[model samples]
Target: MIITEPKPFEDILEMLADVDEVSIIGCGRCAAASLTGGEKQVLQMADKLRAHGKTIVAEIVSDPAICYLPRSKEVIERLPKNGAVLVLACGAGAQSILEVNPELLIFPGTNSRFLGMTAQVGEYHEKCTLCGDCLLHLTGGICPLTRCPKNVLNGPCGDCVDGKCGISSSPFIKEEIDCVWALIYDRLKKIGKTEILSQTLPSRNWAAKTYKPQSIELSEEEIKQRGR
Candidate 1:
C-alpha cells in the first residue's frame, strides 16, 4: 500500500493563507491505514483549518480506492464549493484529484511514505517497491528492492549485521529496517525454494520501471478488436 503521513497543521495553514475557502479531501485506503487521511483525520484537519481562520466549504473522505478516475471524479465534482483543495492522501491521490478536476488548486497535506504493509496499529513497514515488474514468485514473495538498505538484487552484502538490514530514511538511507534478503532466504528455505537464490539475478532493467509518469490506454476500437 502507499503509506502516507500527515503534514503539520501550521504548514497546511500557511499553504492556504491566500485562499479563504477550501475543501478537505481524505483518503480511506493507504492513508487511512497509516492514520493520516481517514475520515477522522479529515475532520481533524477541518477543525484545524477552521481554527486557523480558513473557511471550510466542504469535507469528504475520498474512498481509500480514490485512485479510480470515475469514482474520484464524482466525489470531486460534488465537493460543494472549492477554492483550494487540501488533499490528505499520498501524492498519487492528489494527482488523481487533479486529473478529475483540472481547474481547482490542489494542495497536499501529507507526505507519501514508501509502499509497505501495516505491521501493527500506527506502525507500517515498507514492502513492495511497485517496480512494475514483480519477482515475488521467485523471491518467496518478499521484496528486497524496497526492504534492503542497499537495494541489492543479489544476496545479502557483508555489511548486513545479525540478519538486519542497515536501512533508514526516505529518498536516501540513514537508518536500518529489516534485511529483506534474510527474510527471503528463510522463507525460501522453509518452502524448498532455496535453489532459486543460487541463480544470480540480472541487473535491474531500469528502462522498465524508471520511465516517468508511465501510462497506456486502450481505445474503444482496440477493446472491441481484442474482444474478438
Candidate 2:
C-alpha cells in the first residue's frame, strides 16, 4: 500500500494562511491505513480549521482519490465557489483532485512516504523500491533494492558484522539492522538454491527510474490477435 504521514500542524496552518474558507478531502485507503487521512482525521481537521476561524465548506472521503476522477468531481461539487481545498490524503490523492479542477487551490496536508506493506496497525514496512528490475526470484523474495541500505545487487558490501548491516545512518535501526544479503544467503541455503548466488547479476539500467514513466498496455488489435 502507499504510505503517507500527516504534515506537522504548523506547516498545514502555514499553507492555509492565504485561504479562509476550506474544503477537506480525506482518503479511505492508503492514507486511512496510515491514520493520516481517514474519516476521523478529516473531522478532526475540520474541527481544527473551524477553531482557526476558517469556514468549513465541505469534506469527502474518497477511497483512492487518485484513481477516481468522477468521485473527485462529486466531492468538489459540495464545495462553495470561493473555498480552497485542504487535502488530507497522500500527494497523489491531492493531485488527483487538482487534476479534476485546476481552478481550485489545493494544499496537501500529508506527505507521501513510500510504497510499503502494512504490518501491525500503526506500523508500515517498506517493500518494493520500484527499481523496474525485479530480482526477488533470485533472492528468496526479499527485495535487495529496498531492503539493503546500499541497494546492492551483486553481493553483500562485505561490511556485515555478525549479520548486521553496517549502514548506521538510520536512527530508527537501533543497535543493528539485519543484513538483507545474509537473510537471502540463509534462505537460499535452506532452499537448495545456493548456486543461484554464484551467477553474476547484470548491471542496473537506471534509465527506467530516472526518465519517462513506463506503462504496460495492450492495444485492441494486439488483444484480438491473441484470440481471447
Candidate number with greatest TM-score: 2
Each prediction's whole-model lDDT (CA): 0.82, 0.83
Q: Give the alpha carbon lDDT tens digit for every residue of 1-228 in model 1.
A: 888888887788788889899998888888889999899999988998888888898888877367877667788777654368898889988988877777779999999979888998798877787777788887898887877767788979876677776554344765655678888999999999899988899878789566777787899999899993
The ten-residue window of minimal lDDT in model 1 covers: 166-175
Off by over 4 Å in 2: 70-82, 169-175, 213-218, 221-228
RMSD of each: 3.1, 2.7
Q: What's the count of clashing pairs in each model shown?
A: 7, 0
What is the Cα-based lDDT of residue 38 in candidate 1? 92
Candidate 2 vs. truth: CA RMSD? Answer: 2.7
Q: Which tens-of-lDDT digit does each residue in 133-211 have in candidate 2?
A: 8879999888888988788887688887788888754677665788899999999999999899899888898986787
